[model samples]
Target: MTRKQLDTDIVIAGGGLAGATLALALTRAIPALRITVVEAFPLTPDASADTYQPSYDARSTALAWGSRLMFEELDLWGALARHATPIRHIHVSDRGRFGATRLAASDHDQDALGYVVDNRWLGLCLMSALVACPQVTWRAPAQVRGVTNNVRGVAVQVASGEHVTELQAQCVVIADGGRSGLREQLGFRVDSSSYGQHALIANVSTSCDHGFTAYERFTDAGPMALLPHGSGDRAGHDSALVWTLTDDALERILAVTDEERCQQLQQRFGWRLGRFTRIGQCHHYPLTLTTVNEVVRPGIALIGNAAHTLHPVAGQGFNLALRGIMALVEQLQQAQVRGEHLGSLQILRHYQENHRRDCQSTVRFSDSLIQIFGLDIPAMKLARDAGLVGLDLLPGAKRWFARSAMGLGGRRPRFGAVTQEVMDD
Candidate 1:
């Protein structure tokens, strides 16, 4: 019945990619802020150990330019860049259609559109940086029993090892994931809708080099994305596959052998990447768009998948989450400077309001792409084809689309001089 009590300025639930990244950013922004990150999965001493690490489990993520800037501010990009493959160009096309679009980095006056890094490598880099910070405490392989919002702050019950500890913090940020148990325990309601499709992800090889070109090919079933990656996999595969398919089609695809799967994929994807030679183990995730109606409570806030999860058609899910974190940091910096309560309703509400527009737009953009491009109607097909052609033909339109895809459009949180000054101090 007796438990130890610990107090801190902030408690971040989930030390996955989002949580770890946010923790690093927070320390960089406010070096004096006390923080503790609780992760359900243990940090394996060896990344290659035959064990589970949630952040490292996924295939890969395309880091948008905006995300790159944020990492640069946190001084984590240099390490990340060593393992990242720059996406110099983006090729988008409609299967069996004549219309296509090519977005080159030069067109947008950039050296590269984005970078793709394996999830495992990214996790290692973030965790390594996190452990070096003396201001943060990391509790791994821990279980959160419950959460209670109190008049002054938030109280969390965490069971690590043999003892239960009550962690009291002025603020709690949930970045656990889409199916966050803590979010549910906190009585937050999520509006969720399935896409009736599943994404089959794996590391695959091509006959020829990818040339650091990312491909977005739309087929009858759904969108198939191929992102380039540096050497990592056992077979020396240089690309990550995200092939979306309908429920019926996914069943067939998942049932086939690896060779058969490769053959089928080549048939649908065409000769853009030559032949599909080698493939790693395939993983399937049912696609769904879920968002919490309210991302902020008096003492708690939601970031990453805990706040909203979107379709990967546009590869905006993680990028959107990073943007929201940047916005939240902006608000928190002001609060800290003004000596205001970080867990106050006013501070939480400000973050929610500042992030709402970007979250809604990114989700809508991804969802619309799924609906509009997946249409089988002849008229809809023609319109979609025209849209692609128009985007390629018009310089202004192409530039705008490229910017959005690069995560450069709209209002972005300042992560330059201000961030540097914080690091310097």
Candidate 2:
């Protein structure tokens, strides 16, 4: 296949958060690029914001400060901020322990440490932006069955219902998710280890207000977090919960009555928010640490959970993926300027190299937290308690910890608009 015979410049194999965000970022940075996104589910670009109803059990993602900046560059933050709740303070403590530490946004001279937005609203915003871009095409209710690399580009086999079609693109991005079969189909080596834990997620109302504070409590069972949710009068009263529990514990928690479940939660979580008065529908997800041996190959790349899935102990999964998206976009923009094939190994290698350290550091950070806190040794417990206490007295160490959590500890990618001078070339 020749360049002229290619159907699109890129064929994205999943249209979830990672795929949609990549499409928007690429089109925004390189306006003339033609892209097609293949998603298995239906997308509603025409979703009405005015008629939108917030779900009490809606899933949410914590967008780090750096992620917010990237969205601002992409011009999606304005719409996102409407439904986002600011996490002005974070209270970290060990249940039944003597030490604790708190981080305040005001201390760091920032508006908020982070923002939590429902996944529904975030998807709507991305879909709206994608609908307005003429260079991008959506192939929903469709799946990429296979990808074949040729000397010139890549051939993508897509299936929708009874019809199957093969399209050609210079590059194919696999963002289907952590459980992506395509990655395995293409023979990518993956290393996966289960944490022997499940995260029980739900939205709960408290007897006392959250005061815009997020809580991270380490318990003998596992790590649990409560992120503030809702707005106006509902703001401080509601929170999204992620409680990590072992398989046996998870089974018991799910079998219990709602009242009993709430009581169990109160015991593990203590009375930071007084009491858990109401609980929404509960969902459970097994925790795992999965990493790909190579995130890039000739004519192919993986992003989002497809690239790496971390333990939710730190909520770094999506934020890390967002950073990877921007880095890939920056490299693709540079490749276009140089008139190189989008899937050339040279270009893909640069993307991987530039993003390697960040990926490793983040994965290590998240995994280490679980390893450290999951320990029940008496000496380990005493040391961790002292460390937490010392973290407050040591300003530099505390700032570093806070920055790491905010996703601002490393080389930040620049996703600014490509100059007209470069585009004209």
Candidate 3:
């Protein structure tokens, strides 16, 4: 109905974690930049809080030590702390097998290993932070129709009802979603492969306290994880269930009623968490591996799920996006000091230069983990169990693996107080 145009240092497409975070980071890194973010869907803003935060949602995220350090610097962890659950310990094992490994907070000499949080809480916190930053002019409830790249910078067109207008900036970042129509339109092709699995997520009740332990069990069909949610009135009501299964098996599970579903889960899961009274409303996600080659093209840079969407098997999809966002911010800051435009090829290339290796490694690692672990061969089972035992046999190796999983083992941001050498590969 109404057409409008604006200007800023950076134009971000999509308001998910990556876009929102990059906008806020750039605003803080470069004062008075006036970042504009175009979001396709309209969302309600909770303006009452001193800090922007939304109510916790049913979908949860696993926050690593590295992610926490970044959030702390952005001043988001404090708001999230109120409702977050610490992952005090992790137990990894094969179903009906003798091979198992346990990692604890005491071993790491930290307060906790990581955290399990509602996705909405983190998104709200990031949104709230963006609103508080005077340098950022938040724009959402708008859709992106076209984009252009030139020497001046990358220009993005936003559609509002019958009218379409453009916003030009030094750089344009695309983070819309996995099925990023905008990304495709930019002539960026993403390599995608199916995992042949679907994940069913829901809040569930168990028989006993989870004691802050997270479970990763490999079954003949797939891997299942029982993560902790905050406690509630019902017995074992504090756990969130993330079950991954083959496509056909998942379809059958979805076809059943809630009662039957709970009965089936109780049989396989046993009474580990206590008696499974019932499962919550179930949601299904078709798992796939997607990666957009060339994160930087023309005046556009792809981030988050738009760049790469991995199987949720390891729960590091968002973590990887956040890490990449941090890498981009650092590179941008370096470019400015060199008197180069933030949107210049040199600056954007610097980002692609530094991150291409790490991004590919992470994506490949996630896909391989799902495939390798999903195989149910008798010999493969022995090998996997042996691998778990081998790691445990060496305390040092086990700790290293734990740190890597927490996103803290490698070269960390200075705020994380980790040395650069560790992550420099």
Candidate 4:
């Protein structure tokens, strides 16, 4: 029996946010190109559907200013606006210490520093935009069974239903996730290390209004953040909580009831939010740092978590990946202009080279922050506290931090043709 062969210019494995966003960007950038996205879980363009897939679930994401610009460029921001809550200010401090710093959007001359949007809403927006593109062929509920690289390009074996279809593409992008089987099949070496922490996440109602402010409080156990998530079903004001804890702590926390967990959270986070009245369902994710030493090969590339996974402390994971996607889109556009093969080693190499520095630097920055703050030495603690206080006092230092946190540092891709108000170097 012979399998049906489908051909496209590019085949993207994984139709999650990253894959969907890339498909939209590429279709807009190169309208003539043929693209196919294979996702294991089914996705619907209908925003009303409630099928409960992991990718389009209750998890929330923080979209940095730069990420917002990218979505704006793609014309997907308006769809997400109603569901998103702007983060006008950020309050960072060390629990039980005098170290603290505040970041205000007004001080940076920006309307908002970032936004918090539920993943379900974002998935709907991205899928809706993707459906509008006639150049894309979305294959949901399809799994990549195998991949073979040939002289011309790569051939992917996809299993959908009872049929195995062969997809031939000039380039194949692996955006499935950190544990992508395709990534390993493609022979990319991955360096994975555990952070000895687990993130306990949930949405909760606070006694006091969040006022569009996000808080990051570092504690002896780990870091905890409460990002404003607007009003939800059971609340007047709500915030999404990401509390990192030790494995033992996580076990203990998970063993208790929701009310008990809320009490524990209140004890750790303090009276800043007044009190945690209620908490919704809780989820846990083990913290780990995963990196692919080599991101590109002859006819393949990896994006999003498939490329790297960072600690959730800084909320830089998705934003950094967005920047990398933008850079890759730019390189792909340039390659097309030059009549270069999209899957050629040269084109893939160019994309990798452009993002390598930014990836390394961002990962290092987040890891360094975690290590420095987690130090037990009194001197190091004093130095870190002084650094935070210094940031609060020094306007120059604060501005630099805001710029970097907004994803505007280093070589930023032109999000749009029109001039955007951004910080000057």
- Candidate number achieving the greatest TM-score relative to the actual structure: 2
Tens-place lDDT per residue, model 2, 9-104, is 999999999999999999888888999999999876468665678899998999888899999999999999988988888888988899888899
Give residue 361's lDDT in candidate 1 (0 to 100). 80
Q: Which segments of model 1 are wrong by more than 4 Å?
A: 1-6, 46-58, 231-237, 415-425
Off by over 4 Å in 4: 1-6, 45-57, 231-236, 415-425
User: Where does candidate 2 stray beyond 4 Å?
Assistant: 1-3, 232-235, 417-425
- lDDT of candidate 3 over 1-425, digit per residue (tens): 00123377777888887888888777666564667888877767654335534332378888877788887766678977876788878888877777878888788888777788777777777777777787776566788888887657767788877788888777888889899998888788778888778888987776688888788777777788888777422223467788987788888888999888888887666666777766877888888899877888667788889888887766688888888888788777666555567777777787776767767877777777777787878999898889889877888889887886788755553222233442342
Give lDDT tens digits, candidate 4, residues 95-164: 8889899999999889889988888778877877777788899888998877888866888899899999
**Count of backbone clashes, every candidate in sequence:** 0, 0, 6, 0
Give the total clashing residue pairs for model 2: 0
**Candidates sorted by TM-score, best first:** 2, 4, 1, 3
Candidate models: Cα lDDT each: 0.84, 0.90, 0.76, 0.84
lDDT of 1 at 202: 83
Stronger candidate by TM-score (2 vs 4): 2
Model 1 lDDT per residue over 345-375, tens place: 8998989998898888888888998889988
Q: Which ranges of candidate 3 are over 4 A from the true structure? A: 1-6, 46-57, 231-237, 413-425
At residue 223, candidate 2 shows an lDDT of 97
